[model samples]
Target chain A: MIQLDHITWNVSGRTILEGVTVAIPANTYAVLMGSTGCGKTTLLEILCGLRQPTSGRVSLDGVDVTDLEPRERGIGYVPQDLALFPGLRVREQIGFAPKLRGMAPEELNQRVNRLSEQFGIAHLLDRLPDMLSGGEKQRVALARALAARPKLLLLDEPLSALDESMRAEAVSLLQRVQQEHSLTVLHVTHSSSEAAALGTLHLRMVAGRLEVESKG
Target chain B: MRLNRSNLCWLVLALITVSYLVFWALLLVATATYSTPDSWLQVLRSPEIRHATFLSLVTCSLAAGFALLLAVPVGYLMTRLEFRGKSWLDAALDIPIILPPLVVGLCLLIFFQTKVGKVIELAIPFTYQVSGVVLAQFVVAAAFAIRTMRGTFQHLSARPEDVALTLGCTRFQALWHVALPAARRGMVAAFCIAWARSLGEFGPILVFAGATRMKTEVLPTTVWLELSVGNLEAAVAVSLFMVLLAVLVLVAVRATGEKV
Candidate 1:
């Protein structure tokens, strides 16, 4: 559960998010729809602890998480770039978080294989990031981010980097995976259709103010 | 039309570097292992030569190890922190790099002769000894390693480490398991280049370590000592040793970084 109240963040003194408040219930999907430069990604980053809000209170599961570090927020964030480590193999990449958390090798391998199989990425385990197709890369990135089973998952743009064919396929895959994990999601993107496809709650930010859209 | 000509001219100028590279290669080959069978055997068999080479390796390894220890933390702090006097600290690291080798050596000599010398000597065995060579090498190698590594870390995104942290890894764990592993190629490259440079370091070693025959005579210092004493053959022999060490480092460096 993420409860963001009166959040304000400024980059280089230019306000990105101004007094925005939102609550995301655990296991519920939240999608944020906005135009370019709408601070959608910034809000996602702030919630994950990647960027600090200039002024605000962020509570996670009723605990104050405002000053917490991004890693400490129990978030699995997939940035716009998909940000896969180029040097790491698909299996190595997916297993990185658990390795960092010092999970036993056998345990990590089991969890990684289970996630890989679920995402249909088991065959591409030894492949490099470049070798994977667009849809495949997206799945690998998601699997890597979700490896640790974080409470919240932040996706900057689910299909932004994919071609039209891959994008359609990946969107459905993302929906399945999110539901399977029972994750609280903050999906940020420019497409209303993409948001409507996964969102239980919708948010729109224009001119630095966050507005809750009317329920469909 | 003019841009095409300029591009051709730039390629020509870049190709011109091959001439000097070939010349250096020829120079190294002519002296390496020597033409005569006895002299080659002498280099391997002579206890003085063997001991000096051993001492050089030991000292250079120690210096390179120390440089790595100091460079990683210093590089990380400089790259991550925004503290007062940060720029000054960067400039300080570059002091040995920009300063002429002879000037750095001279400064070290003066330092050892003064009150600071006594303090350093008391702390670690140094001044006109093998330890002195290690200290001199550390100053030069650490500067180069830190500069290279800091740039490497800056080019890398902090996102992967952040991702690791979110999965319950601590800050230090994220750095060790994720960030540092990602930087494996660069770190290895830095270490090899620094080791190569230290192995071939001459001026600072001469001034601070005093080329004390078997005690302080590293390969480069041995070459200088032999040449200054008018033994050209011995000088060429030691020169050959230094060149081999350099080529090994070059090959090691090329092997590590995969251009990902």
Candidate 2:
């Protein structure tokens, strides 16, 4: 479960996110929809601990994580750009988090191999991100995010970069993976169709204020 | 008519570029041709020239290494963090680059006369010492390195490091694993820039280190000392050698796959 209590973020005396509050239940596919420059990404960033709100409390799984660092929050985040480490190969990229956490080499290898196989990127494990197609890079990013096994997955405009064909394929892959892992996801997007396809709950942002649009 | 105008514009631009290229080519060719091969051999065979060459290489390497060590952190801070007076601080970092080399050397000379510098000098001699050569070189070299590194970090996005943070890595880990590797080419470019700058540094070394024979005689100082003694052949030979070293540094920078 994720709970944000009256979050407000201001930059240079300009409010980017107003007093916004919402809750996402565990295993819920919550899609946040907002127009461009509506602070959708800022809200996601606050939840992921990338940016601290001017005033708010962020709780994850009933634990107060407001003061915790991103690493300590136990959340997986995929930024809009994917932000894959360019220097690391696909296998190394996926294994990055676990490797940083001092996971045993054998266990880390097993986990990386499993994720690569699951993502259907086993063959591209040795290749760098630059060599991968847009869809392949997306898969690698998703696999890298999930490698640490965070309870909450926060994806910011994950499908916006892909072409029409790739978007459909990515949507199906995302749905299947979310169900298989039983993961709680907060997916930020502008596409209503994407929300209908993936979200168990829908939320919208209007000038930084969040409103619950629908619930299933 | 539009096509003719475009062609004329391109022709003018090309001529201007070629003129600058020709000027540099002429300077290098003239310097290379100034002295005979026999004079170059004699200069290279001289014990004093050999000592100066060895000192120049050693001091510049040490200075560049120190510059890099200082640059990485200072550059990262300048790029990644925002604090009060950041603009002022950024400008202050450029002081060494902007200051006259003679003034910098004079400042160093005066600074050593102070109580703090006197205390430091008691522990490690720098005034008119071999270490002074490195200190003078580093003061200017580090400024160039820092500028190069700052440009490097500016070009690199912070998103990868942010992702690393979410992936259970601490800030240091993220920097070590992601930022450093991404900045590898930039770091190489910075080192080469610092090395070349240090190679050409003359004024500060002459003032602070005093161009002592076989002790503080770097290549630039060697040229000055040779010219002071009316050894024009030796000076030109040393100058040509320094140019060669500069060319080699440029080649190394290019080999790193970074823009020269």
Q: Against the true structure, what is each candidate's TM-score?
A: 0.87, 0.97
TM-score (C-alpha, index-matched) for candidate 2: 0.97
Candidate number achieving the greatest DockQ relative to the actual structure: 2
Give lDDT: candidate 1, residue B147: 80
Off by over 4 Å in 1: A85-92, A95-110, A126-131, B1-45, B81-85, B109-120, B258-260
TM-score of chain B of each: 0.85, 0.96
Pairs in steric clash, model 1: A71-B165, A71-B166
Taken over the whole model, the C-alpha lDDT of each candidate is: 0.81, 0.93
Local accuracy of candidate 1 as per-residue lDDT tens digits, B1-260: 56698899987887788878889778767776455646766664677678778987888788877887777777777886677898998898898889999888888888887887788778886788778899888889888888867876887787777666666677787667766877777788778767877887889888888877778887777667667888777777666667667778888888886221
What value does the lDDT take at residue A120 in candidate 1? 95
| Most accurate candidate by lDDT | 2
Worst 10 residues of 2 chain B by lDDT: B251-260
